[model samples]
Target: MDFYLLLWLCPLYIVGTIVYRLFLHPLSGFPGPKLAAVTHLYEFYFNLVQDGMFIWEVERMHAQYGPVVRITPHELHIKDAHFYDEIYAPASRKREKYSGFVAHFGTPSSMVTTIQHEHHRLRRAPLNSFFSKRSVVQLEPVIRENIGKLADRLAAEIQKDEGVIRLDAAFTALTMDVITHYSYGKSYRYLDEPDFKLAWKDAVLAASANGAMLRHFPAMLAVSKSMPHWLLKKLDPQAAVLLEIQHMVRSQSVESLQRLQAKKEDNEKTNTAKTTNNDANDNNDDEQAKSIFDALNNPSMLPPEERTLDRLQDEGQILLAAGSETTAKTLAVISLHLLRSPAVLARLREELISVMPTPISTASWVELEALPYLTAIINEGLRLSYGVTTRLPRVAPTEDLQYKEWIIPRGTPVSETSYFVQMDPTIFPNPDSFDPDRWIQAAARGERLDRFIVSFTKGSRQCLGINLAYAELYLTVAHIFRRFELELFETDVDDVRLVRDRFFGAPRDGSKGVRAIVRGETLL
Candidate 1:
């Protein structure tokens, strides 16, 4: 009798839920596929089964249903660029992150994954100064040192048969080393690897590939996360790379904490000795060893709960993953287009030459930033790379959002993808063309095209590593292009196309990404 009743109740409950969602739900009036309104499996089919095609489905929804469409039962996606500010709002506005979207990350304690408005703010407060422009400018030596290593590698490659190289992998190696060095005061030294540690890049991509599936089935992610190392390796070799990365970061965090503790004890002893000796010269002026962990461990900077080893590990994971891949993709994009367009390449090379008089000449971040043509090319690359390549949903817990005449109720999840904004035909005419001149033309006409470039996103939760990314872009591009003459090798526009959205933009699966040959070294 119990079994029979349970079977009957399950169907009835499911049917009743779908019916209520279609006709009686708060978002029922909003236009979208009835199937999407009824269940998230509609999203699952596209993102997981169709391989990250949900973003395209959303675009089609906006095309057919209008700019504002309910993408999920509880979430609305607004395609209009004008409405972007209201959704991603400034620090003054109280915008919470949607937990449904954030839960997939498996990093609940990290600043990026924090769901509440106030809690995210608390987590992010101490990190601002570290990623600031001033800090990045100070860290320019680190950026150049890595870029110089890359240049040396490229220079050496010129001696090979075709001097063929995978710019995508090489760029990833460069960025990975810089970020790891920044995080732990020691780099993974990916740039030193012969194959540029392709497995590590695969691991990053694999983690992103799992995100869409995890979003739909968070319980599976939770279970997988808790599984022992041996089981995880058996289950999925690529996914296991994520665990290895986590363990490495956690170990670094523990070491940093221990070092901080030892430093405190040493300082206390020094003070005691000074008091006993009554020595005026004993005013110790020891500078602390610096790493992101050291800053995070400071008790005065963050509260006790926020400074824990667990919190530090979670933060480290987000920092390293966030800091690496996206910037590398942008560099790869810029390199592809530059190699394809001789005029654009010539113009940029001329500009770089003016600033850097010789092939091995060095320039400051400020100096590189001032080159107008170079800046324009970077802006174009960012527009195309589309940063996260997914619709980042934000929730307003306290106030209703106004989109045209529609009233989006408080606590409703709303999103505007950077893809739509970056490639809007009205804003960027010939949006598919890799034309840096669009930026230059906009500037001459006194139009501020920068507002449409949301690759770094906008408002309170914008990318924390923007300054570091810019520094890397400016330094890497200026150094590489100025020093080496690279040509496209078995690569074309399709090699850098935004084919799939694996959290970040991706080219087709089997595609060899953005390969180029070192023609020769350039001299002034």
Candidate 2:
């Protein structure tokens, strides 16, 4: 009797919850599939079981319903390109990140994953000056050094019969080296690897691949992070790589803290003896701060609680992942399109030659950015890559969000994805084609096509690494095109096409990624 009563109660409770969500929930008035309103399992089927196909399902939802549709039972998605700014609002408008959405990456303490808008600003304030455009321009040598190394790697491939290299892995290695060097005052030197440390890139992608499934079970992220290496390897080889990364970052953070403490103690002991010594010590400390880790650990920059080892490790992981993967992916896309279109490639090479002259000649980022054709090519690449493919949900904490007739209640989670905006058929005609002239023509008519490029997003929570990413794109694109002649090797449009929406965009499963043969050096 007791068992039968318990079983009947469970079914009744589930039915009650479903009926309440479909009719009694605040978001019930909004448009979307009734099944979606019933339970999150509707989303689970598409994203988790179907492997990141929910993005297309959301598009279908918009076509049947209007632009504003309840995506999850608790969240709303807006498909209007024009409404992007309002959702991802400016600094004045207080917007917080939704906790459930943010759990995808599982980096709670990192500025990128910080839930509150105010706290994010507090954390971001000290690092702002370091990532500024002028600061990145100052750091150009670090970028060029890595680019030169990459060029050498490709040049070596020229000697082999196969000569075919995977651009995605190669570019990932380049960006990884640069970001690691910047962050730790030393690089992982992935570019130095024979196969470009392909496993590390796979590890990063594996983390992203788990994002859709992890959203519903965020605790698994913590479980994976804490699991013993032997057990983790049994679960997933990539998870072991992920664990290795976590351990590396944690060790680095500990070393940084120890160095900071030692410096402080040494300065204290020396302070009583000489004024000149104090000034010299200050200069030395400033030099030490060149490493982003040093800056983050500095007491002047962040509070004690914020600079804890665990938090710092989280920050390091986020930096490495964000700085490397997105830029590398964009570079791969740009390279693919350039190799595919000989005419565009020739035009770009011609423009680059006017500045680069010899194959080995060098040009500054500022100079490369000034070229109209090169800039158009870059803008087109950014459009096609579409930055983070996942929907970034932002919440209006203080006031209601107005979208046409509907009033989004305060504290509701709302989001817009760049993939949809950048590829909107109404805004960009022939959205699928790799045409750079669209940007050129749009610019000739005084149109602001750049406004549509929201790859880095906008407003207060925009990616802090934007300057770093742009600098990498400009230098890498300019260097490769001007120095080497590459041809598509068993690669086509499908190689770069985004079929899955992980945190980053993913091409179809089993795709070899963009590959090319390094035909001898470019000769003007």
Candidate 3:
């Protein structure tokens, strides 16, 4: 009788485990490695503790599971381009971002995080103006002006050191300045400031680090908040930084609006004077080009209902966040690659020399778009050092999503792992090698490069900053390479490590950070 009871208990335990995983687990039905379904503790261990190398583990699983693999019970990690279509397809009813990560301040839902379709639509409408082709073209001068400042600063630093200077910090500063200028319309200047604002920088870094953990473990956020205020502060330095950045951003945004209002009033007064005196016309015309505020405030430009403070601020924050790190990181990685490959560097320098002798004072969007080598180098860099990886997860708003032989249940988090897809050996031969020739060849054959290119993502939810990012990249790379020769010192290609945050990736241990040795001062 005792032996019979023991036998029944053993089967019960085994069945209980299976039942718990299948029904009780957060991500049960979605196919994945058995371990992943069992628990997310491994995922957390790797991401937070091991510095985000878990994606490689997921890739290995995909090798066994074909295109789709469940990394988590609720999450499906897909790599096929067709899955991209199914997820981002226009007709496919999907909500905004998932509620895994909450906003830092206020209940305001920005374009990137808003979960509701209608709310996202409302938020994205006015914001679209700032990112439109015409708008970006108009804002080109702002980007160029910032780039010029950075070049001048770098040139000065090089001159001081006989044309050799570390560029990691410099690039960060430059991008920060550029984003600030664009976001606040030249009101705040971190560029010329002698000392870096620790609070601001810390806030951004902290927020970024915590953002990933919060997204993965939403329940822990409340527990994290419940800790003693000082203890919490001590435990999560990044949380403070995140809050500080949001505060600074909000404060700066309010100040920017105020300045715009004041400028509009001044402009009105100037126009009134011109109308009354007729002699003031010359003075009014001589006033600097219209600010971002002027364009937005122009009554004829957008409908009256569209102009709202909340909308403008929402768009401004998105633009600032989207544009800043992406361009800077791309430049940093491209510079690193060029420094490593003398042949590539020389070829690029030759191309720049042939294109513009005096460092291209001005190039139209169309002209820049046509530069083959420039496009190749940028595309290659983007491919290698993709700023953002991790699947852009979207939930199926409908009852079911049918793809191939599987019916992905509604509300299941479905996403394409861009990093894995972009690194496919079949699509990009020798995927690890930084070769621009692949892109050039593909472009020559008229193959639609956008199909597999996940740098800017695709469909309606694609990066709105795509054009701006490209423009900034082209101008910065073209101008910098044209003027200076970037040289890597005591560094190899393998030395650069990926510093992965929740949403994006940066260089770890400042690996890409290197000395830029002027051509005349160095022997190749």
lDDT of 2 by residue, 54-151 (tens): 99999999999989999899999999999999988889999899988877875667888799987998888777887999999999999999999999
Q: Note the residue pairs that clash in candidate 3.
A: 27-73, 27-74, 203-241, 206-238
Distance from true position, residue 19, model 1, in Å?
2.5
Clashing pairs in 1: none
Candidate 3 per-residue lDDT over residues 233-256, each given as its tens digit: 787766645444555566766776
RMSD to the hidden true structure, all candidates:
2.1, 2.1, 6.5
The C-alpha lDDT values of all candidates are 0.86, 0.88, 0.65
Query: lDDT per residue, candidate 1, 344-392, as tens digits?
Result: 9889989988889898899998999999999999999999888888888
TM-score for each model: 0.95, 0.95, 0.80
Which number leads on lDDT?
2
Least accurate stretch of 10 residues (summed lDDT) in model 2? 278-287
Candidate 1, run of 10 with poorest lDDT: 280-289
Q: Which wins on lDDT, candidate 1 or candidate 2?
A: 2
